[model samples]
Target: MMKRPFGIAVAQLGPIQPSDSRASAVARLVEMMREAASLGARMVVFPELALTTFFPRYWMSDEDAIERYFEKSMPSAQTQILFDTSKNLGIGFYLGYAELTTDGHRFNTSILVDQTGKIVGRYRKIHLPGHADHKVGKPFQHLEKKYFEVGNEGFHVWQTMDARIGMCLCNDRRWTETWRVLALQGADIVAVGYNTPSVNIHWPEPPHLRMHSHLISLQAAAYQNTTWIAAAGKAGLEDGCHLFAGSVIVSPAGEILAQTQSEDDEVIYCKADLALADTFRQHIFNYGAHRRPEHYRLITERTGVGDPLGKEPDPS
Candidate 1:
């Protein structure tokens, strides 16, 4: 059986400040959808924490302010317009955001919606970074751990139009567990969105090739997993803070098929053959045929509640 090829857009966005309302931020998303839809892209990938600036840095003494940034649910009154636009345009998308769960846990998350404007799946970022407290003496900004709890759920995959779609966010990509979990589950494409700040005060100023290295990480993960990948970014200096912007679409062979420029805002468009993805999966990089899960039994495992895979393993 032959599968049809599809195209996706990595609509790398510029920075949105704390003042940018959901209505306004979503308006920008809508424009990308319309443009991508016109270009025949079945799906579009937006940046991590796309609805607002990366606000986890500032600790809110007043908790009510959390409601303003975190979406109670997808397509809240402020976001309904973007959902409506997707329905009217007939394209699917994966949107990243800060989510407040009913249990009072905050998560870094993303959702997958099909062309008909229905949410098919959801994934939360597993890697929680930065220190919890805002230490005045500790170099730069610190507070994500203070604001958002570490996501307990792991990676996930969804069946869509004969392609296995998967989602992971910024820090999640730095870890191999997220990609491996999805790869084992038969994901054909992995979508990642990030807002990587330029100030790595901990280290010397990184050279320009770092963006290329970032793409390599995504590409290598795709190759090792035999999956196509679309990684988008929130680029440019947002209110004086600069972020690295190098959105990319990579083939399963770890090749850069399409990529955005190194600065400001841009989008990368690439046609991906779902069948070719299978070719890679079946050939050299076949994940299932070659992976050895039993060997990892050396690592002691424990059980825990609320585990995504089942009540089975303790998150080490």
Candidate 2:
């Protein structure tokens, strides 16, 4: 069987200011969708927390104020325009947002909508980064651990028209298990979105180094998993935080196929031959023949949870 090429667009957003209304943000996303369609892309991917500013950075004492940041309904009237636009253009998309389920649970979630604009799959971020409570000494706050619950559902992959796809959010990309789990389920392409501040509040490093770290992580994951990776970022400075713009599409061979040039709202596309994954997946990366899960029970037994202060693992 011959495999077809899938054109993917990675949309890097600058930032959604706290003052920007949801409608205005959707309008911007709509424009990007049109741009990607014009570029011959069949799917477009946006960064995590795309609809609003990265609210996790700020700690709100008022519960109502915190809830205000979450969307009660996924395709709320404000976001319906995005679905309508995608349907009109016949392009599918992966979008990340703050989800407030009717059951009263809040999650950092992302959804996969087919070309018809019908949502086919949904994923909640599992590895919630940052501290649960506000730290007084940190220059700024990273309270995602406080705002969103740890996702309960496990990693999942969806069978789409073009390829087998998977979704993961910001910090999840840093964990090797995130990609491995998806690969084990036969994912050919994984789309990840991130809203990362340039400064590591827990421990500060050079801004350029932080950006380099982002690319390295993406490339390594692509090669290790033998899958295509489309990673989008919320770039530019948001409020007082500076985010690195390195949104890129990586091939199964770990080559960067396309990337955004600016730290702003930009759309870049690449036509990936989905079959390319077979070159590696059936060879050096063949999990069925190479993986020995029974011997890896230690990984499952040890959750690897650590204290926020970076405590060394007990060498017991």
Candidate 3:
């Protein structure tokens, strides 16, 4: 059966000021949603930590001060406008935020909302990057490992209006296992959001190579998994840290369908035919036909060890 083309959007947001209130943030998001709706986008994706500045960049000893950045509930009085606007415009959106559960667990999380403004799926970031402890001499801090607890919800896909959707945040995009797990669950499209710093502190990476690595990862995952992927980013300089804008939408064939043109607030739209995934899934990359899971046990069993079994594969 041929599927209808659905218009999707990647909303690249500029930096959110440290002093900006959630109401102001949602207003900005609503304005972007209006633009997307005008462009006929049925689904839109926003960036990680969309409501606030990249707060993890600052080291704070006060727990109360750090907790201020997390949302206790989605669509609270401050964010209700985003939900109402999405429902009114009939446009679903994927939004990333800091989630504080009732049990006091904080996570780097993203939620998928349907066109009706209903929360349909949620994903917590699995790959928490950066140092957990405060480094006194670093120029800018990346305290994600210190601020948020490791996400417990494993990668999963959901049946949504346009396709089987999956969600991941930031560093999850760099891990091949992230895509493989989602693809294994039959995800037709994956939504990802990131706020990557232009500078790599641990091991300095060339600025150009950092962006190149990002694009290569997206292309490789899209083609290898045969799934449409939309990646959005919080662009521009936040405080003193710079974030490059490379927001894009990728086709099942690993081609970039649309991308942002600036390092600020921008919206890029593309019509995606999700059914194209079937061609690769049923033929060349069919898991049931070609996947040799028996020979790949090391991927799941090995933990922080290069050669856990101490045995090499026999050359037959």
Candidate 4:
């Protein structure tokens, strides 16, 4: 069979300080987009909350956060340059930002822009991590649950750039069900953006395990679902808190084809053979051939671990 190759890039961004203006951040993104185009990439993926500092780290009023960090419109005055450049370079991009709706709903969102600079798809983050209450003694807060509402739109894939593309943001990538839903929809490539802290605020987790879990999640997802994955991260120190950088592009065969070497603004590209997934999709990972959905009802029926299904209750 002939190879169906696609060129993709992951643009890893450095920290955006709390005082940094949106204009400055967009300029950095435009620079990386140009570099990715020059390197022969058809599309690029940027990290979560790329427009501002990771504000969820601080506890603030919802109204204040929305006014300071959320975007009312995608191509507003500050972000128009990204679309213009995309159209000029004929390169598509995936960007993550805070989206405030006209109806007053806020979401941690990511949009998929085509070569024409038009947004073809959008994904709101569903699996919001962290607590709504302020952790009094912790160095930083993870207030995603408090600031943003749960995503309403379900996982979806779009046909563009001659391939099926799906998107998920931050913590969503850690869930297997997220990958399975997209793969079931025939997704060829999955784009993920994240802003993860280097330290665990809830427990004394070894810092190294953060990077390890990030990489392993993508590798396992790619191989199991037989889809290409491009993950971008906002790394390095921001306001004294550090985020690890291991942005990577994983092939369907569970291999890291490319990875960012620096914890700064970097672009890593790979020309992947899209057809390579067919070998596994048609055999080992073939959902239609082997999946037993009937027996997996517990996944959606309950939120936490419980007694074994069909097991008899112990006599009192």
Candidate 5:
């Protein structure tokens, strides 16, 4: 008998502001979830910082604002409704948020909740960007570094819906190590979500088609790792900045299965096969089987000050 193809959805959310209520956000998710189910998706993935507009820049001096935006727990009363909705629909999801710990360790977090409404696994973002201090010329895109600490939990993978799933937040996909670690863990699909803006004057990448910012990073990661990737985005103009929107899903064979259009909330849908990952794994490109770790001793070496063989010591 031939194996069946699994399915996934890229839920590209539009600009959700500080003014957007939790009920409204949950409603949007409900609609999207139904839409995905209609498209035959077994699973769906939302963008990083999905609950609200990316808030790292505000320097949120008012503690109340911080608590209001940060999710203290998964399925908080407002979010539990989403879990219930997914359970009813029998479609699992991967969600990202600004998580506030009980012990006060805030992090950029992502979690996998099954169709049965069970939390399967969680991951905190290891790569944190933006400055903690307010920049005079740059306006308010400041302070993720000062607010939420870097994620302590390393990269991870989960088994869900007959597929080996993996999760990563914004900025994590920029580093190959993110995909490599999960690939080594035997990942079949990698879920990534972001809320990238149009202008930053900082590390602005060019678009492969219409815009330089989106698509490139996602396609690169999906193709290089030989794993399916579903990338969702919070896009469009929010508080004067235009967030780029190009949510997409790619197959292990480097084919773009689906992609969302610009500046609006949309769902890009496609069927993902759990077994296609074996095509890459069985080939010489398999990282676990063919990785040259012995030659990789050079990455950690300080090129100028230290030698790979540790022949020289730093002058500092």
Candidate 6:
């Protein structure tokens, strides 16, 4: 089944210092969006919290965090230009940001906009990582749990711009269930945005493994779910903290079609064969033919590892 190829891009952002204004950050994004359009990309994926610095690294009161980092509305005065650009260029986009709702709820969120600049779907980050309490001895804090609430809405896929697209943020990409839930809904492409520090604050993890693990996780998810994945990262140093950059566009076969070479603002484009996913999904990942939901009760029933569910079948 041959389908029209779709052009997609990942726009990797450089550091956004604590002092940088939202206007400055959005200008950078507009530049990249135009560049992606020039490259024939119909859609561009931006990094997590692209409008501001990764603020969870600092320990601040909820009031200060909301006032400084979270956006009360998606297309506020500072961000309206992104939507305008999308409409002018006739391109779609996925953007991640810190969201503050009218009901006083905070969430790490992302929105999917179609080519006409209409928001088609919204996804809040489900897998919030890190600790709620501040660690006194650590160099920097990862206080995501303290700042944002766990997303209430579950995973979803929306049909727009001639494709079925899904959205996830940062830590969600590392979990298998994230991809599975989106795949089960027939997502042809998954757009992920992240802000991952080069060093692990909780453990003495080798820095190189950060990039390696990032790539491997995307590759594994793409192949297993038979979906194309576009992941963008806010890279470079921000207020002395380093975030690694390896923004990539991966194919359904788990092959990296394009990757950014620098830890700065960059754009990588790929002409993706939407039907490529069908080749694998129709055979290797034929869920209806191979899945066994009855035997996987442990996945939903338990949160922690314990004794085996039942003894192995007796040989006698």
Estimate the TM-score of every prediction: 0.89, 0.94, 0.95, 0.96, 0.90, 0.96
RMSD, each candidate, Å?
4.4, 3.0, 4.1, 3.5, 3.6, 4.7
Worst 10 residues of 6 by lDDT: 307-316
- Please write out the lDDT profile of model 6 over residues 67-128, one tens digit for every residue: 99999998999999999999999999999999999999999999999988889999999999
Candidate 6 ranges beyond 4 A from true positions? 307-316
Could you give candidate 5's per-residue lDDT for residues 1-316 as a string of tens digits? 2455988998989888777887788788778988988898888898998888777756567375467778888889889887998899899998999888989888888899888878898989888867666667675575677777889989888877887889998788778778878888888888888877666645454433334435666677777777889989888877776678878898877777888876677988887776677776777467766788889766656443446554645533
Worst 10 residues of 4 by lDDT: 307-316
Write down the worst ten-residue block by lDDT for model 5.
Answer: 204-213
lDDT of 2 by residue, 1-316 (tens): 3776899999999888889988888888999999999999889999999999988888786375456689899799999989999899999999999988898888999999989898989999999988877788787888888889988888999998568999999999989999999988888899999999999887668889988888888899999998899999998878878888899999989899998999989999998888889878887898888888999776666655643333546644
lDDT of 3 by residue, 1-316 (tens): 5875888898999988788788788888999999998999888999999998888898886376446788989978898888999899999999999998888888999999999999999999989988778878888889898888889989999999858999999899999999999999988889999999999987778999999999999999999998999999998887778998999999889999998999989999998888888787987689988999999888977644564554544423
User: Model 4: per-residue lDDT, tens digit, 1-316?
Assistant: 6788889999999999999999999999999999999999899999999999999999989989999999999989999999999999999999999999988999999999999999999999999999899889899999999999989998999999999999999999899999999999989999999999999998899999988999999999999999999999999999999999999999998899999999999999999888888777997898998999999999876665675655534533
lDDT of 2 at 258: 95
RMSD of 5: 3.6
Model 3 has an lDDT value of: 0.89
TM-score of 4: 0.96
Which segments of candidate 4 are over 4 A away from where they belong? Answer: 307-316
lDDT of 1 by residue, 96-184 (tens): 99888877778888888888888898887777777665557433464667767777766789998457999999878776667878888
How much is the lDDT of residue 298 in candidate 6?
87
Backbone Cα, N, C clashes tallied per candidate = 0, 0, 0, 0, 5, 0
User: Candidate 5 — which residues are off by over 4 angstroms?
Assistant: 1-4, 62-65, 203-213, 300-316
Stretches of candidate 1 above 4 Å error? Answer: 1-3, 62-65, 137-142, 205-212, 298-316
Evaluated at residue 152, the lDDT of candidate 2 is 81
